[model samples]
Target: MKTWIVLLASTLVLPAHASNHITDSEKKTPLQVETIAQFNGIPWGLVLLDNQTAIVAIKNGAAYRVNLATRMTTRLTGLPNVDNRGQGGLLDVAIPPIANTQNWLYFTYAKPTSEGSTTALGRAKLDNNHLSDWQDVLVTNAVVSGTKHYGSRITFDNKGHVFFSIGDRGERDLAQDLSNHAGSIIRLRLDGSVPSDNPFVSDANSRNEIWSYGHRNPQGIYYDAKTDTLWSNEHGPRGGDEINLIRAGGNYGWPIVSYGKEYWGPSIGDGAEKEGIDNPEVVFTPSIAPGSLLRYKSSNASDWNGDFISPALALRHLNRVSINQDGEYTETRYLEDLNERLRSIAQDDTGVLYIGTDSGKLLKVTLNGS
Candidate 1:
């Protein structure tokens, strides 16, 4: 359930630019943003297939194949009917490498269950317009008793294997449980099997699919093009949102070690800076509630060169960081004044940028300098 527990600061009017525009109430900037297409439901995922084509996944259990040049959108068929209640709904989507040869697409959805709903990640092919040859790739192991915190985001590595993020399922202790997949990073074969090289393949205290553990609800999972390192943005309780560098068998320490406290305003473990718990590369004391991640290589916009971009939903700003060698980052730039919940970020092969908003709008941000 969406709560009005926030009061965003008003944005100041900036010079006319492609990244932002001044609005009246200032409550919604990108809501009226111009784009080639729009979303029919709560947007969760976005990706650029190429220069002219892009894909957007919505909570309405639909994914839209978009053409940027023509300003047209085509709804891809054969998506699952999701349990769209509370925060449980259709989630992350990705076009895997096999999609090139087989038109295969991977997606995750909230599968209805008697206890509640368990988040499931599945892979299937798009047979000319229909989803054909469907296969169940993976399902979260923990029992879901609540409709909140179903963290289901998917990505692929250089080896072409799949790495998915499963939320803690609102049961904090489950994150520390090795038998459960909840609140951990799961790495799997493209055909949906646990790989042999996994950290806990034969461990009695861990699930084979788990790459890392102790995460609350991570929304962004991206692989760096050069380093091949994975980066994720995890949502903290109230504040304490984090940008983490994920490693094989690393423990992120959610309820055990956190930058923020419990939602009821109690202390969450030791603190932000602890010894055993891996600290975040950067922490958002007042949470920005990051939803999507896009690593820029070449210039996506006029001002932004190659950098890691995280769109802030609760903060309504885009924070850009310069990646350094020692696995650290410096705040390089910030795209401010967009007062809307940024849902996703994508840049086509040609380098044009597109930002999707939760308010049913798609924004095309470019450079206006001549």
Candidate 2:
């Protein structure tokens, strides 16, 4: 028989005053420990796949599969060669809709280029303990000269087409260039082809794959189950981290006009509000260095009905932002005690919450709250 431990948060605070953001009796404890893999560095991406397999991304161009029941980690193959410099490497992964029918698993990484470095998407079929028939799915149009700011986060729409977040590639002006795919959200077909219905497909001045533009280095993307909406969290320069409601062809202002300041303590742009540029739904003042995003199941959440929980690398905690029926949000921070720089979060169909930490710990947190 397997043993189970139950832990509840109970923090004691001053009786004179209290705050709405934090409860006086809030806490969390580790229920179980299963150290599947210990890397020399941080783990990048993690998501639970169907049929008892889970996917993970390691920084140095490696991806693996873990069996939750058996705690068996089998390193899969076919990841792109990445420089693994300051902030560029194998970034994020997603299993396309074709995975069910076509057996295709998609991933993104930095491809070494002559000019500098470029981010590219690759797809491979997960066969018996390995990836076979790998294909380079998509490569961004803009050529990057640096190893930083390659936004390779990939998510799929309900239509079976794909949506990817491309970073500004360290060049602020490229974010405003409609002709460039960098610093934009792109929509593409499953076979590395452009979608005809993309936001800027017909405009001669705009790249056809551009779904939305003006993002910095966005790492997280999610399709909301409750609202059927696309949501993302992007990192800010000094401060001013953002959580955005991703819309087709929406232009989210980056260095053109950000809520953050420059490294020299100067204004990033004219101001936060600029004409025709979309404001973030939420912005962080102190800067959380946000990572990947995952929504929570109400069945396991105690007070929150259903909330979008984003991981923070700088703060090393998870942010739980709640949404109304209409998709408007009210925010709360959950699982502060995890004290781990959570890189990714995924839930199994059975309500087991799996979180990947920067220190290479893959945690399965099962909630039992009344």
- The candidate maximizing lDDT is 2
**Candidate 1, residues 133-233: lDDT per residue as tens digits?**
77778767765768777877788887868888878888888887888988988898888888898999989767888999989988888877577888888
In terms of lDDT, the poorest run of 10 residues in model 2 is 11-20
- What are the lDDT scores of the predictions, listed in order? 0.72, 0.73
Full-model lDDT, candidate 2: 0.73
lDDT (10s digit) by residue, model 2, range 170-269: 8988998998878987778888788778888789998898888899988888776567888888888887788788888888988778887887798888
Error of 2 at 66 (Å): 0.8
